[model samples]
Target: MTREELIKNIKSKQSFLCVGLDSDIKKLPAHLLSEPNSIFAFNKAIIDATAPYAVAYKPNMAFYESLGAQGWTALEETVSYIQNNYPDQFIIADAKRGDIGNTSTLYARSFFEHLGVDAITVAPYMGQDSVSPFLGYDSKWVVLLSLTSNKGSHDFQLTEDKNGKRLFENVIETSQQWASDKEMMYVVGATQGKMFADIRKIAP
Candidate 1:
């Protein structure tokens, strides 16, 4: 989805909520276990209930990927269901995938062409070549990992260099050369607090 489309959805719904569909089969309610595809069934129920209040849905890929082919099938069904039923809602495959250029190209094709998600979280640790391939698709987004909320984020994201610029700051500045805000976004953790003001100085 384009930035304009996403913004419009938020306005129409009067919300900026992005529901995370981290549907772990093992954590599913016992009642749903009898369903032919429990994962998809669980996701459908959540999506239907939350669609009215949310503008976006983010399905963490690891949960489904761990289940093998069955999980993948459920994921496909979930995406299809949302596309057909809630077309206005932005769908994000929260797969923090990034690799060499050739591999990234395939990853891009799989998410953008095959699974047909609007955006995918990408690990920018591999640098621009690893991320550029995903930017080729119009209206598709590359949500780069920036300042994460994890405890380990301090290990790298906040580290400063000889020039005194923090790693996350450098990431935000350098990545802009690859794509504009229209097609790219950064994942800034809510816990970052005042650091968000710092990010906006560079990103905004």
Candidate 2:
């Protein structure tokens, strides 16, 4: 979805809620376990229930990937269901995937062409080449990892260079040269708090 469409949806719905479908098989309700595809079944129910209040749905890849082929199938079905039934709602594959250029190209095709998600999370540590491939598709987004909420984020993201610029600050500033706000977004954690003030100064 384009940034305009997403913003319009948020206005029409009066909510910018993006629900995360991080459904784990082990955590599913006992009754859903008997379904032919329990993960998809659980996701379908959640989507139907939350679609009214949400403008987007994010499906975390790890939960499905761990299930192997069956999980992949479930992930596909869940995406298809949302596309068919909740066409206006944006879909994000919360797959923090980033690799070499060739591999990133395949990953881009897999998510943008095959699975057909609106966006996918990407790790920017591999630098621009690892992320540039994903930017080739129009309206498809590369949600680059920036300041994460995890404690370990400080291990790298907050590190300062000789010039005293923080790593996450550099990630946001440098990445802007590659794509406009329409096609790219930074994963600024809510826990980052005042750090968002710094991000806005550079990115806004």
Candidate 3:
């Protein structure tokens, strides 16, 4: 959706909450496992219950990808359900995909064309070309993994360079040139706490 539309939703609902639907079949409700479309059933229930509070939903790709075809089918159904039932809610494919040019283009099409999510989490390790292909689609976005919440994030993201800028800072600074804020966002790890204030000044 366009930035204005997203803003209008947030203003109307007075919420910016994006629920993560990282549902695992093994951990789903005991009864849902027996349903013909167990994953989708559970997801539909989740969206129904949380719909009032959430403005977005993120379905982590690994959970569905692990089940192969069945998982993929469930994922597509989940996206369709959201689009039909709650058209205003933003959907993010938390796939964290990163690859070379041609492959990245295919990946973008798979998510934007096939699965139909509003955006996808992309690993920026492969740089601009990897993320830019996804931006080719109108009103779609690429959420670049910058300062992650994991402990390993400090290993590289916080490392100081010759110019004394931390790696994460550089990622935020350099990435803006690749796409405008309307088509791009940086993932500032939730664990960053106060650090988000800094990242916002750079990106916001």
Stretch of 10 with least lDDT, candidate 2: 188-197
Candidate 1: worst 10 consecutive residues by lDDT? 188-197
Q: If both were scored by lDDT, which would come out higher, candidate 2 or candidate 3? A: 2
Tell me the alpha-carbon RMSD of every candidate: 0.7, 0.8, 0.9
Error of 1 at 149 (Å): 0.4
* Stretches of candidate 3 exceeding 4 Å from the true structure: none
lDDT of each: 0.94, 0.94, 0.91
- Assess candidate 1 and give its TM-score to the true structure: 0.98
Give the Å shift of residue 155 in candidate 1. 0.5
Q: How does residue 163 of candidate 2 score in lDDT?
A: 98
Candidate 1: the clashing residue pairs are: none
Query: Which stretches of candidate 2 lie above 4 Å from their native place?
Result: none
Clashes of each: 0, 0, 0
Summarize candidate 1's per-residue lDDT along 59-155 as a digit string, tens digits. 9999999999999999999999999999999999999998977899999999999999999999999898989999979899999998999999999
TM-score of 2: 0.98
**Candidate 3 local lDDT, residue 42:** 95
Compose the digit string of candidate 2's lDDT tens values, residues 56-169: 999999999999999999999999999999999999999999897789999999999999999999999989998999996989999999999999999999999999999999
